[model samples]
Target: MQRIFAADIGGTNARFALFTGHEGSLGLDTVVWEKSADLRTAEDLLQIMQRQLQTPLAEGDMLVIALAGPTHGLRGKLTNGPLQVDLGGVGQRYGLSCCLLINDFTAQAFAALTPRGAGAKVVRGRALPDTESTQTKAVFGAGTGLGAASLVCCGGEAGFRHWLAVPSEAGHAPFAFVGAEEHAYQGFLARDLGCDMPTAENVLCGEGLSLLHYYLSGQFYYPAMVGEQVLSHDTPTLHWYARFLGRFCRQWILNTLSRGGLWIAGGIVAKNPQCVEHPAFLQELAAGGDVGGIVHATPILLTTDANSGLWGAARAGLEHLRGQTLAASAKG
Candidate 1:
């Protein structure tokens, strides 16, 4: 059996997995988790893997990593954290024959490409449109930070296909305010952060929720409490913030309509089930004053999964292995 290593590196934690190939199907091994602070860079990550697996690294060992940052141009800088990874340098140091660096959202998009058994719940969205060729899919995830990506699929022989991951900084795009409340929050962000430009990360992410709660309630609360408060449905502030997020999600979906449908992933959304269950979440999305009609036509949040990024990284590693084999066969 062929084996490959894959990792999903986030700001707080790094999830590593091993995939074993069997009869053209991939079986996932148990996931290994490590704190990001304990492992600073890709070199440090390799050291941890080496220690855990108790094996010597070898050439032709593929490593596919999905990082929480912009992964364009062969190098990526973390958006919310202080880590820089170079694709070429990491691969060289790890003694691996192949390495693929992908945006965390791109990894999530790969997971969204194939539906898991009874895990994915289809919410509000048009069925993926049929295309003569492969279609594109978009991914949106909110957690320690906000991340987004697009995947373009290309058809191949025998019902097989390949996918290209398009890394995007869409999360960092300027946030659009619809009404007085959001405008007020935008102003608060500007005044507090000393920057007028606020992205979706500023008002819709995990930290964003805490910030919103503080701004509204005039009380300091931990980020975890914000979720608890929202889940209890006791705080109107939390509900209002959820509506804010819904509106922003609507705008994002409309902005990336070419990608067909949007898939919301990450632990933050999954943890706060009440927010997802709130009727106002969908109402706010459909209640567009001007752009609401078009935005409402686009798909909203369907379902979220915790291990989507990890699964995506594994899938990418498998794809990378297949590509390498094909390239070697062509050369021979």
Candidate 2:
């Protein structure tokens, strides 16, 4: 049996977990979440997690951290927080067998493979065809910012033989708006953002949620507060937010051609499933013009499992360990 330590480090929170067992059958042993801001000036999160662990770290255990931003090889810096991660240095400092770093959304993509992501509420389309096994699936969500990633599976009914998680910085891309009203709202966001055009993150995140509420109601409130209003009342803000999310998801689906499906994960949609459940959301998602049939055929699911990122990181760690064992066997 192999041991793995996995972390899902976001802008606001950092989650750590320990998993045991080989690839395809890992079990969670322990998990904890800490405020990322608390460790901004202190020791790195790995050290803190190590000390908090009931079972002390053992040599040869692998570590995999999923960061909230793009990664270059085994290192990445969080886009919305203060953390410059270097997996190689982490491995050296912690005396681990291997260390890996991946984009947080890529972790979500991998999570789609595990049972934790199963039984998702289908908000927009039908379930994947039974014959479908080898295809691409995508996941995106809005939180501190927007994130996206895709998973490429290769195999058949027997089961997937390989999986690849493709990370993206697509959130930074400019968002398109239709109609004069939307254009005016876009201008408002652009001016507020100090950019000529508003990116998806500027209009789809928590700040965006608050900004949208203010745009419609002329009153500023926290995301949670706005979420409460949206959940309780059928306000215009809810419809607009749902439309924007639907449009964004549609664009992502078209860009990735993820016919296998698109899974939505993030605090916004996960906490308030009604966001996607709203008719406006599906209307916008299915509004692909000539390609409406294609959009209609693609499955849409909402990921409600909060620990999905941790599970994804653990899955990644197991794959790393498997690769190492394979390499050693080939050499011997």
Candidate 2 residue lDDT tens string, 149-192: 89886442243346778888788899989899999999899888
Per-residue lDDT of 1-332 in model 1, one digit per residue for the tens?
66667778787877877766543455676567877765555667777876665554553367777888777655676665677776666666667777778888778877754433124554566554332335566777677777777777765543446677777777688877767876877899888767879887877777777777788788766778878764467477657766876776676666665335667776567677666567777787777563536565555444565566777776677666766777798999
By summed lDDT, which 10 consecutive residues of candidate 2 come out lowest?
153-162
Candidate 1 accuracy as TM-score: 0.82
TM-score for each of the candidates: 0.82, 0.90
Candidate 2: the clashing residue pairs are none
Error of model 2, residue 148, in angstroms: 0.5
User: For model 1, which pairs clash?
Assistant: 288-292
